[model samples]
Target: MRDTASPAPERRGGHPVATRAAARLDRLPPSRWHRRITLVVGIGAFFDLYEIFLGGVLAAVLAAQWNLGHTARSWVIAAGFLGMFAGANVLSVLADRLGRRRMFLVNLGAYSLFSLASAFAPNLSWLLALRFLAGVGLGAELVLVDTYLAEFLPRAVRGRYLAYAYTFGFVGVPVAALLGARLVAGHQLLGLDGWRWLLIAGALGAGFLQVMRRQLPESPRWLVVQGRDAEARRIVAGIEERVAAETGQTLPSVPEAENVPERRVPLGEMFRGDYRRRTLMWWVFQVLQTVGYYGFGSLAPVVLTAKGYTVTDSLLYAALGYCGYPIGSALSIPLIDRIERRTLIIAAALGIAACGLAFGFAAAPWAIVAFGFLLTVCSNVFSNAFHVYQTEIFPTGLRSSAIGIAYALSRLTSAVLPFVALTVLTDLGAAVVFAGSAVLMVLLCLDVALLGPRSTGRSLERI
Candidate 1:
């Protein structure tokens, strides 16, 4: 492939050195170096997804072991999300102030250490505390992933590669589900309960991921934003050389881009000027989308149990449905760069609304699995679009902070959603729960269709 530079002028928010560095990195064709970076980041992210879905499985096991009621079970689920809220808002601020790579390492270590600690918790209270701490670490993860990938990847292939990375990460969902089904069935590993084994495995995997992440170069775009232009030039040059050697071709010339003076953007800058509208749009989108995405994911076993499945049967069925996460993400890789991001989110939201309703009313076993699978597929497609979309809208100066604040709201919704969702499920029934989701999706579709910017094929600085 002849890699051509994006015609979008990289104006505002960066110096000429920044513009040149971004242009050089963005003009290179996708190569082995890019793929390796994608895979490493994706694998690290796999543990985050594992932890997210792990809550659903663990909630079932803990309930059985402790004989907890609806409210208690809701607490078990909400603890991690609440921690995530704190992590996303607090640690993400550090990511912008400190550096993407520094916060990346910090959050991963926090999640891993706390997860290991949670496995040893002797009671519900301790478990909740540990999970919250772990979540604080996890909160910054996906936010960092979006910020990091957007900074490193070229414009032409940015959305597609981001989808590819998340596709690898989403594989953790079904794996956690299947493992939960098998392990949670009175199974043990290393003399611990199956559920404990799951937490341990996630922590151990993250330990290995930390080692892999050491090989990754910091984002040159970020370095430029930090006024470290000399270092940024060196890193961009290395990237260009490696990509050229792998592609066995001369690299494209860097396109002309406007140079704006670099300065530290204040945290409050997200709610001012053009960013205020973008921030509000993202906040609304994040809140509603969480209700649609994690609403089903966090409550999968509960939803299935409501339909008369035993706990064991619910886990098994949930495993089958979770298979759609990776499958749907993989299927969307080709379409991510091709379609307008907002359009994909809108279409995917509608799909979730439709499939979620069907899943709610499904009686027969086969029907449940089918609709569950389709619903998850749509959820992942929606997930991929928004993850990439949010990062693209903000400049490097505030990308991490903007996404963190916006994404923290989603975590907040996830924290509170279980209580609300479960209460609705208990009162009105499962169909009404999905009907509520349908309304949220309709609102999301309208929000994006009206307010979302066009991001496909545009450079990060330009967007």
Candidate 2:
């Protein structure tokens, strides 16, 4: 499970200290330091997804309990996504301009408080408002995790490690699904609805993680970008010492740092020159991919209910299917760094398109379970590939902002997709909704195949 860093002969960055810090990181083998960081950050990601999918799980039950129409149901779900749009677009830029660790904790704290408040909401409007505010905190979390990992992890294992973090994080999906299936209708504990208990659990869990994450060191690469070479060097040296002690292996010598042009790329740099095409491709991919991913993912329980399954049956089926989120992510860990990220993305997306279509028409319980499992597995592989891909293609200066802006649009799609998918399912059927999903996945596959950059086994700066 250990990997010795074999840094490239030459690397590029804004400062020589940052370049050397990156090289030193690349030379250390995988150790407790990487795992600790990955696990710590993964916990935050777990809550992010738990909160995201909890909305869908709650939608059907709340609709029934409150006599919510389709429009009202859509608003309930869309509220969080709308907040995510603002948080991601705004805080992501601040991560780049400010420090990654600062914004990371800030967003986590914001959501944890609001999510707990949401559990006590007196009405639908209060619940929606709290969810929106909590979502603002949820938005920048994953973005920062990605930025942090891509900066610190050795290039040799970067893709796989990110997959590893997400594998643990994706476990939240199944946990949420299972909780929804069991608790959404059960007797109230502590004089609260079962649904309210779910929110409280997520909020409390994230709050604990926020405290644990204070031990995380800021990204030395980011520190260098801020012209704080002494601090960057100290942090990198401390990490190297810890990794060396844990691995008990003689570290390889840090490769000679190459001096590339050191000017900080402007925030607008993503829209110009070589980056423009990448930016456009990311934007388009974000929009279309959300329709395929969240369309089925965030709305599966409701879609099942719309298909005539009872709330219990729908949640149970969703729980079974959501198991694939972690399974699929785990499966990707071995192949993620080995395969070209774009190729993996294209292949998994195609699998999603096919499995989604099959799941749409499946009637037998066995068939439903089979296709749902396959679809989830494929989607996680697709997710793992793209999550790593997006971080790799952008440099340190533009990574957070570019990803934030691009991801914000996906939140927009996620916000509206419920209404769109629900409208389609109501007007036509589940089959049509999935048919549309298939088309969107195919379009996304084509987009990546055509425009996505090759980022396999490459350093962040080189890409």
Candidate 3:
């Protein structure tokens, strides 16, 4: 029999609240609530990805208008990455302390407000400054997505759920490319620059998202970690009740608790003991990943323009080729639950390497677009798994901080990579630039094959 004064001791999860919350969450079937959360959260990510890609298309526009070289345009891109570095490292910490829902709202406002202001920028200097400020919110918003979803989802379908949401986000790439194809054609929209109109459109979208976010519930796991036992139970109970109604069946009994005590864990804890090794692994992984991802995404159109395609052809072809991103990522939805995450990551990395090499060597436009499409498909395949892997490796108390710190380090590399990619593409050529990317992908494949954890179908606490 259980003790009357205190609940049955859950040795693994440590606290009664955490044990109950995790049990209930893991046992419930997917319901309308799950889809609703995924849609709202995914929409926020859609806007963020759209804006990030828009920066690239807009860079192409500004390059001609401002008579800017690839090197100068790199600074325009670098400013956003540098600001994201600060935002991810700094504001992300607040999510752990202040609460996820509040920080989510604050970051969205920060990003959209600055983005709207950027539309009015009179010169390159002002545009750069506004983009940098917007990046602060951009950075934190990403971390929160990973943090919230990991906590809300059940272990059985967590990986697939994230992929579904991420699929929605990857669509933003093609959408941006398509929109840019139309918007970049002229300065005829109320006499405002097309790029300015693009920025304003993104800001308006964020405002609509802010209203949608009002219905989101707090993360029960986070509440449990904060020692707010009653609140966590209430949230979990409400969710369980809804799931029961949807399934028309009785809920499963709570699983045996994993005993992790409720205590105040300090930030420094992630850097010591077993987590020390994990932190080092994630930091290296993130930095290399960002260099490969941002380097390619931000500069693909520019490279096409450099290669003798007319500006119109470059943007249009880039749009056509990037249509593969969302489709490729959507492929992962069926596979994520069946395949081990580390295994899938390694496989996708190899595909990226192969496709990137082909893209670099192809001289014909058809070949370039064909190979570029393949590369993007592989990248998004890699991305869906990669985003989920980082948050899975850490404990709840340190989850946001670890992701934030590693993400910050990654953004730091991304901040520098625009300049690096520009220099390499100019000095060496596309073949050599992608050769470097291929090598990085090979290294990532090996690292994961050797050091990465097995996370599929495992509880967040257990992983």
Candidate 4:
């Protein structure tokens, strides 16, 4: 077992209270309280992915309704990505400044409110605009959740707990797929178009989350860094009481930790030291990873339609493929803490690339679904693994902003990639499109494997 006596080199010129608060937070073991936190936070993530995956399925239906060509179809899919790009970069900077709990609620409200408006869109342009607005919340919500989980969870089982949270989030993938399958079958409900009904479902779920989130406690670590030591101490004390009651054991003494100063961290700090190299690495990974992951996800149904599947049949198959997401996350739960995080990310990426090659060549229904399922499974494993890895490497102060910028690149590339992928699919073929995905995955594997930090057993301060 790794020793906890020394987490990192002690820093000078730091507040004692901030150090004490960080120590208290880093000392707790897993409990029902943590599970509750995950459930509450993870549910919002459900709607984020729900709106995204559901939008992909709706692309074809909307295109048919508007008599849009392939390029317009690509725009229908890309617009939300564009909005997400802006949201991740702009709103995430505020998360570290404003507090995770407050931003979580605000982002949720943006997502839920806009999704409701999206259902009422009278023209293609209105739908695209509303979805773009909704995408903003989706973008911020994802990075903040990763930031929250990393801070709240201790280093020992951090990856596993994160995997569990994402496993809950991944459950939405299958739920979205099942919902897509249902809408394709039912056609409509409450006199609205079937696609509009899908948007309503995401909106209602997010609305309920806003009410549920009121009970959530703010991050003690965040409170400390902001010089609100009294509040941070009170929060940790309550957590200690609950943990003690659950475990029926007195908690061990917390190791001494150096204070993480409460100060204004400029956005430019990321490009200034070792963080500069780290930032560049994630930027490259995010750009390439998005092309392989979302490129296939958002455009797969459209390609299938062009290959002669009816709209309903294409959605049914896509829904089945989406099931792989949760299954992949589930598989990672045990191995996440046990294996090296970068190792898993690299391995999963290669598996996904290999699966992509097969998916492009497969023509039979069973073969196509089989390859797609395999691809999504491997893709999500990489996703859950890296989400934990990314948050762990950065300081609490820089965590949200770092990921915000990285996720923006992920979304930005995804926004522009649809046009590229569709053009390739339209001219060259499905094989070429997926072959392109394979090449990007290879690049991602090299970037992460060579440059990513080892974080599983190290404290956040040490990492």
Candidate 5:
């Protein structure tokens, strides 16, 4: 239970709430619970990614089941993103005001229930409406998970830990793709369409996890902001004890009232000075990168089929593309803390451009597969690196809101790209589509590299 007796803990040394939380976490060991928290959060994130990728996986199946054209399928896939944009932007402010843990649980429950409803949709319109509603929950869940992890983990291990969690989380993409392929590749079950079964299974799986997540504690830092230092101390002490027993090292001393001065952050301060610039840069980067990234991945099968591959071959090829997610996640671990985030992001973006061009122009099937894999690898690298970068840039007081705003823009841009890609590629050809994406990547990379700060290895307060 949250402590109700003490005055809210003061923000230490004028640092943001998250930075203070990060500092406190530095005192603990990297223990089983620590790893478990990371894993559980990743699991939750996996379901989030599952929902995002499921739309793409179901598109081909939906087309066949409904006898719809490419345009209609594109709209269905885009609807989720449209819903996500609204959720991220609207709920993020509430996260700051109401509290992270509260909002997190609400988002999870909301999405899970709506997703379950989607499984029973009688027609395309019903399915699309349910998907959009579920997407709002999904959008908030993604932002909250990132914020929660960043707050709870120590800075020393934040990059690598987050990388591992995200890598494993994204492994859900391949899981969803492979499962959808196998299930839908055959006859329907229980007289319900195979595609409907896929939706039901995913919804039920996510709902189960949300139920389990109630065991999770709220962020101690949020408690501190509400003037519950004693409660915050109790939670931190438990974590420290567990970590010490697991790692066989004494936990470092937490700074006490005698050792450090107190500070507080007013909500309106984010709009002043350098923070405003940083916020704008993140928003722009997210919007452009998402468009380039999702536009390619969401349409991978369609693009491949357009190049003359059979349906089985296209699905297999798309699976190969999905594999790049985990690989990219794993590869980013070592580089995340070692390299400048700005540099890594720029390189990843340029690599995406090169791979996109290569994929568009490749005539041979093997060459297309190879280039598609490379593109996904680079795209994930850019994505994971930015995920860490953006969260680390803001203070705890506004972290969720900032991330939510930026993430919302990304979803908005992504929502439009599928329709745009379908329309443009129809008349302009795959080469032009790929080439246009390449140009966007290059320009966005330059903008971020030149304007964005180097965030790796820095304390959140310093950032």
Candidate 6:
């Protein structure tokens, strides 16, 4: 018989001669290197949420300063989603072609510069333009981070790790909201508008994160795919060594037999093969969840105010609602691995529907706050589960593209949501808006329950 013990086919560089090097990705306990990488990537994601949340908080300020009508204000709020639509589809493809780390850096730098420019916008039109541009970078940054995190972690802990990674991003929302409330509530700074100062401050923070991210290494898995096996080995070994040093546990060697094929499937292939049902299921799931999520999230204060609360009361209630995000995200970390993703998604959708309807009908401020908090908690739970689910459904070859396309659809729907909200609330009231959202959520839950695949602990390749 041929030598059964021969070394697996080595790729270029000193890496073991393995066919599917990515499948054999080294797994180790969390180390300083892993923590540092998570921090850098998580901070980048934080800025992305900060930029988006800041816009919502500043909308009222912009309306007063710019003399913008409700329609015009909705336009400004919706513009960023337009940019997100373009960026997710375009840059995601480029990310796969270039590299996850490279695209992430480019997006961070671009968004930071644009966000700073937005602080000085002379008019509403200019501000909208700048916000749109900044959103392009924001969109790409979100997709690339998910791609990078999925590739960096092992399959065993991927669900929990990704959920934890996303918690950092959600944490930024409340931070932005609290800070924006302080900045825009009254005090001006050195002849600059407080809202403008807020945007500028966010830009500066983003730039700081960009510098830190520069120190992060590219995903070793990506390097292996590019035929840089020796470099991949070095990077993985470094991670293993750091984890060993930190956790006092020896890292296990990767199994040679677990290597996968390296062929890159085209983006179109996602809709044709084993991925077809998942693609359709996620597309519907994302669209409905976003309409429910952003519809309430972007307009929380406005909705509260519409229900006869004072501005201060509305802001306070909205703050309480936002607090549920981090709580829900944290709660999902342990549950994501324990429960079926589809089951959690379906339950979350139903909860969002029920709680949203209750909040819509409640007149008392405390009642609305309580119901809104429940709705927000459920919405975020669904968000965390879906985020983990979407990235896990695709192989490394098309992970970014598939996720980006689904995310783009969500943004595209969100781009139209503000106008939809404005029209419906103006004609039918907040109850109708919430009631309709409930219908959508219920339908989506049914779709996911009936058609969605189970992907809780499966590998991307197996999915």
Model 5 ranges off by over 4 Å: 1-22, 254-268
Per-residue lDDT for 1-463 in model 4, tens only?
4323222332435545656666666788778888888878877778877766665677777766667887778878887888889889888888888998888888889988998999999988898899999998788888988888777776777788788878788777667656665776447777887778878888888989899998888887778678776787677778888877887776767776655454446788889888888888899999998877777677778878877888777877877887898899889988888888899999999998999899888888898899999999998888888988898777777789999999999888888888888888889999998898899899998998777888777777767
Model 4, residue 373: distance off in Å is 0.9
By summed lDDT, the worst window of 10 consecutive residues in model 2 runs over 1-10
lDDT of 5 at 396: 69
**Candidate 6 Cα outliers beyond 4 Å, as residue runs:** 1-20, 23-26, 256-259
Q: Count of backbone clashes for each model?
A: 0, 0, 9, 0, 3, 3
Model 1 lowest lDDT segment of ten: 2-11
Q: Rate the local accuracy (lDDT) of all candidates.
A: 0.87, 0.87, 0.80, 0.81, 0.77, 0.75
If both were scored by lDDT, which would come out higher, candidate 2 or candidate 6?
Answer: 2
Better of 3 and 6 by lDDT: 3
Model 5 error, position 444 (Å): 1.6
Quote each prediction's TM-score.
0.96, 0.96, 0.95, 0.94, 0.92, 0.92
Predicted candidate 2 versus true structure: per-residue lDDT over 229-274, tens digit per residue: 7787778778877887888887887666455433356888998998
lDDT of 5: 0.77
Off by over 4 Å in 4: 1-16, 258-263
Q: Residues 226-286, candidate 5: write the lDDT tens digits.
A: 6666677677667766777788765665543222222345656567787888877887788
lDDT of 2 at 461: 69
State, as a TM-score between 0 and 1, how close model 6 is to the true structure: 0.92
